[model samples]
Target: MEFKGAMGGIYRLTEWITRLAATNLLWVLCSSPFMFCLILKLLVMNQNLANESLQMNWAMAILAPLTLFPATSAMFTVVRKWVMGDTDTGVFRTFFKGYKENYKQSLIGGIFYTLLFVIMYVDYTVYMTQLSNLQIVGVIMLILIIILLVSMFNFFSMVAHYHMSIGQIMKNAVLLTLIRPFRVFSTMLGSAVVIFIGVKYPVLFLFFIGSVVAWFAFFNFYGTFLKMQDQMEKMKQKDEEQESVEDKKSDNLQK
Candidate 1:
């Protein structure tokens, strides 16, 4: 009996891991184009020569959103559903559904964010050119801003998944970040490391690694959220059941 129980536990754990891995794989495949476009945008942004060709840079900037926004929005939607136990939705269906549903909002959000990023970049360049003394503070502020933006994106993705309004999503995201800073940081750091490795190697293995990382990060955020949501629901149910039982006992005594 003990051996059987232990074996069953192991099997269940393995199954859980397998499911997580499968979900991650699906997410990566669905979101590949967005990922590629994002990387390309980052590359262009990092290049000093990119600033020299204003038209080319603008073109890249414009294309980046057109290529990546809808895809990313769809990827997030699919991954959120998958994490919430909707295993029937295949990668293609999820991708298309997400893309179609979120196209306009994603486009608008992407344009807004991208414009903000460009403005920040120009500001940073101007500051760097003018002041050598404030470089460290500016760099630190830039890093903080990047982290905040990424967190906001994650929150918005969750909002999109849950069909929540942007305002509510932003509020919840801010609360979640304040309450669970470590988890948020871990997710971001893990994702950054994976992407960094992918970029550093830029070979097949690295591509695979980055894909795996992206998937893991996407699912991890949603999965953890779902688990917490489930737990809360369970607790609420239990409390209601207990209250009902107590009420029945009291009525019986009165009778």
Candidate 2:
């Protein structure tokens, strides 16, 4: 009996370790596609920072949205499954499936996002340099820009969780931002804190930065999605109840 109990404990221990290792491994794998493009974007943006070539900077900016969107889409796909207690699906299978399914829409979104960033950056620069009179306008633009960015934090995650068209997805994200502003701010703040810590300790970024951030982002998003879902359900129930009451009143009159 002693030997059997010992064997059972060992089996459980090994299983736990194996599950952890497998999860991290999938995260690492998902982060690969984004890594290369990230490096490219960094290099390009950093080039000639002192006396930057405008066209070259904007030209290379294209790589980021194109690459990051697809990879992010895939990563969230795996993250969504894992969070929802459905980790049995092959991680690779789910990752690539999301990448393929969300590719076109994500690309469009990527371009849209990148273009918005570039436009904002350019406007900021212009206002600072040449368009001084528009500084007030620039400040308003800055607020809009920040909201767009905060909204983006949950954009891909929503794509994983729902089946809206890209345009609708974008609109819904904006609505989500309006509805759950606090959650949106909290996610961005948490992400910034993690990223700052990772920056201070480069080793963290080396192995787990991408996955760690992704896991938390998905976790945060899952919470927000649940709240939104619950609210929607409540609204639906209320509508149904209202309709039923109205129907009963009509029936009484008919009788």
Name the top lDDT candidate.
Answer: 2
Pairs that collide in candidate 1 are: none
Evaluate all candidate structures by whole-model CA lDDT and list the values in order: 0.63, 0.75
Which candidate's TM-score is highest?
2
lDDT string for model 1 (5-55, tens) is: 999999977755554455445545645565555556566667855554565
TM-score of 1: 0.63
lDDT of 2: 0.75
Q: Candidate 1: where are CA atoms >4 Å away?
A: 1-56, 170-175, 200-211, 223-255
User: Where is model 2 more than 4 Å wrong at Cα?
Assistant: 1-56
lDDT per residue, candidate 2, 111-227, as tens digits?
Answer: 888888889877877876788887887887788889989888678887888888899888888788888888778888888998899789966655555555666777888998788
Deviation in Å, model 1, residue 232 alpha carbon: 6.8
In model 2, state the lDDT of residue 175. Answer: 84
